[model samples]
Target: MSRRRVKPSLYISVDIEADGPIPGPYSMISLGAAVAGRQDAGGFTPADPEEHTFYRELRPISAEFDEQALAVSGLDRDRLCREGADPAAALSEFTAWVGEVSTGAQPVVCGYPVAFDWMFLYWYLIRFTGGSPFGHSGCMDMKTLYAAKAGLPLRAVAKGTMPRHLLSRRPHTHHALDDAVEQAELFANLMAWEGPGA
Candidate 1:
């Protein structure tokens, strides 16, 4: 009697720079994603973070934006207003890119405390493209993953609190592509790690 083998989940590390708290009123100024790794029955394969990547800067949706939120990303709003990709077109390209890369695996968005990123990403993909490549709920929170693997309380999970070996060597820059690359390194480390019990 042979059992079927389940395919690994293709962990896609994503980072987004947004202006304001939410999506409708605010907007995602930039987006980035990299194929972090694939973890399955056999084990894990750490992808080259530089390969299989996507990045885009989009024009603001509404006039309303928080100064602080906009300042964090350090992107020139006026420049973007003059030369940014259309939101709908950018998202459409993103969706197609996901499908192309994830031929036989499930694409899972993996980010630190994924909720914030997901909120904007999902909203944009759904609103602009009319559908999300990741669907309605395929987000993996690295913070939560670490908490479970380390057997630590969720509240106790922070980058400073984690074991040095588990964290990414790269610093967290606000640039969406850089952050996504940093997160890809982190995801690869997490996928290859064997916790307390195997």
Candidate 2:
């Protein structure tokens, strides 16, 4: 006489800044995440992304870094070297925060192009925290979601191609937290959209 429980999906918008192409050689210099919303049988319920967010600038794991990659974030690695958070503690805190925000729901991370962000995050989570709050497959790509919903080819779909209404008003600052919040708004908008011709 017992019924099954269905956990809702808590969509988290995450963005990271790294110093090189991959995780092992490079390090995740910064990480930012915002609770975009939750989804269940009743559909999506958007959150105030600003209300629940996390950001951390981490110390470099290695001495090697690509200058071009470092320039994009404009973060002072020298300063980070002296003052940034330890990778293990930072990721542990991140895991705790994700757990707190995702209580009663499943934490599912989403990013503009999720592959890159997920790559760095998953690697760091396992390397530093020993695991991920999102498990192995709890992820969604905003670009791919938009492509599927809007019926456009994935390669041709970019922020510029999307209808203005679907885009967030927030500027795409290179700052991790800023971009995470911006993407949260975009995620909410996309979730509610019925797509073109609907």
Candidate 3:
């Protein structure tokens, strides 16, 4: 008999702290992700009871740590070697874990400043896995979505004062997991006001 597969609806909130803005030339100092499973059709609602989250820290690949980024994140490179997993190993494990969590369901992967995070993650995934399931197609940028749904001007929204304030409220602390959780909270609030359709 064939084994029955579990189809869990999942959403992933991910964040990455890099040595600098550019990829290839730069490196991902760390990464954090929060995965939640949907309990019902409410669709990523705050009230949903069937949600689980996990966090992981990755060791830096290069010694060229950006002083400003490091100061904000407060992650010690020496300590990361002791506490965090290897970069390639961590990415492999994380991708497999996400696949397991998502299983038979199509998961929505979200990030606040997706352009930055996605670029690094995309590069890292393609570098190791040969390709990324998340390519530009599967990612969601909450800031852009919020601006559109709230009917706010792009300039005003981009400032993150009105519709995009949630992204700024938490600030970019540099810790990957903390930032991911912050994005998750912002997403929850946005979903509450705009409803699942938004």
Best by TM-score: 2
Stretches of candidate 1 exceeding 4 Å from the true structure: 1-5, 196-198
lDDT of 1 by residue, 54-151 (tens): 99999999888899999999998888888989999999999999998888998889999799999999999989988888879989999898888889
lDDT, candidate 3, 53-171, per-residue tens? 54566666666666776676676777776777776777787778777766666666778768888888888887766766555466778777777777776556653464453442565
Q: Whole-model lDDT, candidate 2?
A: 0.97
Which of the numbered candidates is closest to the native, going by highest lDDT?
2
Per-candidate TM-scores read: 0.94, 0.97, 0.76
Flag the better candidate by lDDT, 1 or 2: 2
lDDT of 3 at 4: 78
By TM-score: ranked, best first = 2, 1, 3
Score each candidate by Cα lDDT: 0.90, 0.97, 0.67
In candidate 3, stretches whose alpha carbon ends up further than 4 angstroms from where it belongs are 1-9, 36-51, 81-83, 158-160, 163-172, 195-198
Question: TM-score for model 1?
Answer: 0.94
Candidate 1 overall Cα lDDT vs. reference?
A: 0.90
Q: How close is candidate 3 to the true structure, as a TM-score?
A: 0.76
